[model samples]
Target: MNNRLLTAVFIAAALYLSGGFTHIAGAEDGVTFIPKESEIVSAATGKSISVKSTCPSGKRLIGGGGECTGYLNTLGSAALTINAPRPDEGAWLVECTNLNRNPGEIRAMAWAVCADAGVLEKNR
Candidate 1:
């Protein structure tokens, strides 16, 4: 059935897309991508992404990514800063807090979209 085929295709795409956490979403920065800001939240989470931000503040952007479990990503490499005077090849600044909690080797994947200026600019 067409519906079944579409479902299969979707699943395949998801697996292929999420296969690697490294290449997903723009740099770990906390900035938003000029073109695909929404991508940050699209397919960017998994059952393993137990850790997440609280009351996030930033521009209206989107991203896609996910987690595998046992991996803890830091903010300096996770948040995206979109307020830079000029953007790079879409590499936003990703500042994060360890929370001192990790899934333990399994590693979880995740992404964010926002205009974190202070943190990102200071570090960048």
Candidate 2:
């Protein structure tokens, strides 16, 4: 029930509600969501780390998110400074800083939600 967990839950719920992980029924717009995940990175106290999830070829990034997990620090848990889509790079970037002063590890992962470029064009 920490900040990081709450943030992750919130993101998951939002994605579920928005159908970011499912195909729409009877919709033949050729729009589909492809999810990608980065390898987990662990950071020590007072350290920072960054990770990215890149979409496969022919896919463009639409949305993304990240997660941080570990023991809480004196102030709080690790902070997510960036959780955004990198359309130019066709990826999702995630950065986190470990504010914990004690001895522990903070792990982070990046998630990318991608779709056909044609879908993006249609929406635009």
Candidate 3:
């Protein structure tokens, strides 16, 4: 009886957690996915990408065909994650690997969402 109850508990927990799993519908994300501009970039591979303060502020490229191409090829898919930094402000963390070619320059004003948010509005 105890074993059966334990199994039921485990199943309940799994279902509860899995129920919250989210799927981004209709979002197109190629390798090295950056959903918005001005997001911090990954300095290294196989690790959590971060926000780099060094990114230029005046609407310029962030990561240009940099070393990211090395890791992008290793990944089959990537996610463009957004973290809220402040109220009405957020930053992106992206991981990219060039499957066929080198990564081009990066900028905070690169995505339509960034323009709508007014973070990269001036560049638009």
Candidate 4:
């Protein structure tokens, strides 16, 4: 097991030194992975607001996360998620709802991680 680990590390080091993994997604080769983010805030209290954010051309969504913010110590929360349909498209959807039935506004944010479309092609 130890020998296998050592071998893997040595191979990675060699590849790095040889410039096999030096180019970024935006480089001339366009083989790097870049992260994309999107966010949406709710306007009305006690109501659910959904928002979607899209990625740029030539990019694909790989991962995502989200969060919600509302009144302090109040019955309010948010839900966020990622919507990825294809390698060329992705969206961040956020829903904020108030449970206290009060006049308050909540905010929801979603983050989407995107990568160069070329990266996907290379792997396949």
Candidate 5:
């Protein structure tokens, strides 16, 4: 009986050391996030202008945001707007407007994170 128990222990140790039946799980479809660079936005008459960044093929936008940069955002009346990425889409939209009723150009950047649909589903 002692010999049989020792043999069982040795077998279990070997299996563990050999990585048998481990079956480690990971992301489903290789989902990844990416950040987009800044883009240019020009608006007149306090009207809002939109800029967008799209992900590559076979990838979808997970989240995104934007901010307005320039003298107008600080000195002049300027505003920035960010919208969430739609389902299964790689489009991130941002709108910037000059709130001072003056014609000016402001620099804005839109950023987004993308991932594969299958991977996203696995996460959920």
Candidate 6:
């Protein structure tokens, strides 16, 4: 699979394991998958940019991912250097570098999946 697909699968698995799944009917499991997004940031050619998404009050981050856009080819694509939960467990951080030779701009953003901490305990 491609890097994007693999990353998505990994995030899904992490969310599932962390009790971030919501019910089909949206019933109260106290579990909520809150997707927090970072503002789009530009990375210059050969330069790296980092973005972060933080959970709201009373929510804890379970998993997260990121996207890099505006690239020429596989070799010139923006490569993600870091895509993981923050040490505080309340945010998600993502960093990517622009590999294009030209001084073009690339966009990168982070996504955070959050859930109620108490809900996680109840679900377990």
Best by TM-score: 6
- Judged by lDDT against the true structure, how good is candidate 5? 0.57
lDDT of 2 at 72: 39
Model 5 weakest 10-residue run by lDDT? 23-32
What TM-score does model 4 achieve against the real structure? 0.49
TM-scores, all models, native as reference: 0.23, 0.63, 0.20, 0.49, 0.59, 0.70
Cα shift from native, residue 63, model 5 (Å): 0.8
Per model, state how many residue pairs clash: 42, 0, 7, 1, 0, 0
Lowest summed lDDT across 10 adjacent residues in model 4 is found at 76-85
What digit string (tens of lDDT, one per residue) describes model 4 on residues 1-124? 1225634754564344335775323334343233333233334545655444555566566444344555511352433322233434465454445545445556554454455655545533
Model 5: residues >4 Å from true position, as ranges?
1-42, 86-89, 122-124
lDDT of 1 by residue, 1-124 (tens): 1225634653454334334434332334444433211212212322122323222444432332323222333222222211222122222322222343332223322343334545333332
Clashing pairs in 2: none
A best-first ranking of the candidates according to their lDDT comes to 6, 2, 5, 4, 1, 3
lDDT of 2 by residue, 44-120 (tens): 67677777888788766666677665553334668877777788898888777877665455656777666665654
Residue pairs in candidate 6 whose N, alpha carbon or C atoms collide under 3 angstroms? none
lDDT: which candidate is best? Answer: 6
The TM-score of candidate 3 is 0.20
* 1 versus 3: better TM-score goes to: 1
Off by over 4 Å in 3: 1-46, 51-68, 72-87, 95-112, 116-124
Which of 2 and 6 is the better model by lDDT?
Answer: 6
Model 6 CA deviation exceeding 4 Å by range? 1-4, 7-11, 18-28, 32-42, 72-76
What's the lDDT for candidate 2?
A: 0.62
The models' CA-based lDDT, in order, is: 0.31, 0.62, 0.28, 0.45, 0.57, 0.63
Residue by residue across 1-124, what tens digits does model 6's lDDT show? 3466957786677656655766321225443454434344455677777778887888777666776655422455777777788958588887777776655555556777666666556646
Residue range 1-124, candidate 3, lDDT tens digits: 1225634653453334233225211112111213333333433333334232222232222121111222332452222233222212333233332222343322222221111222223222
**Which residue pairs collide in model 4, if any?**
25-32
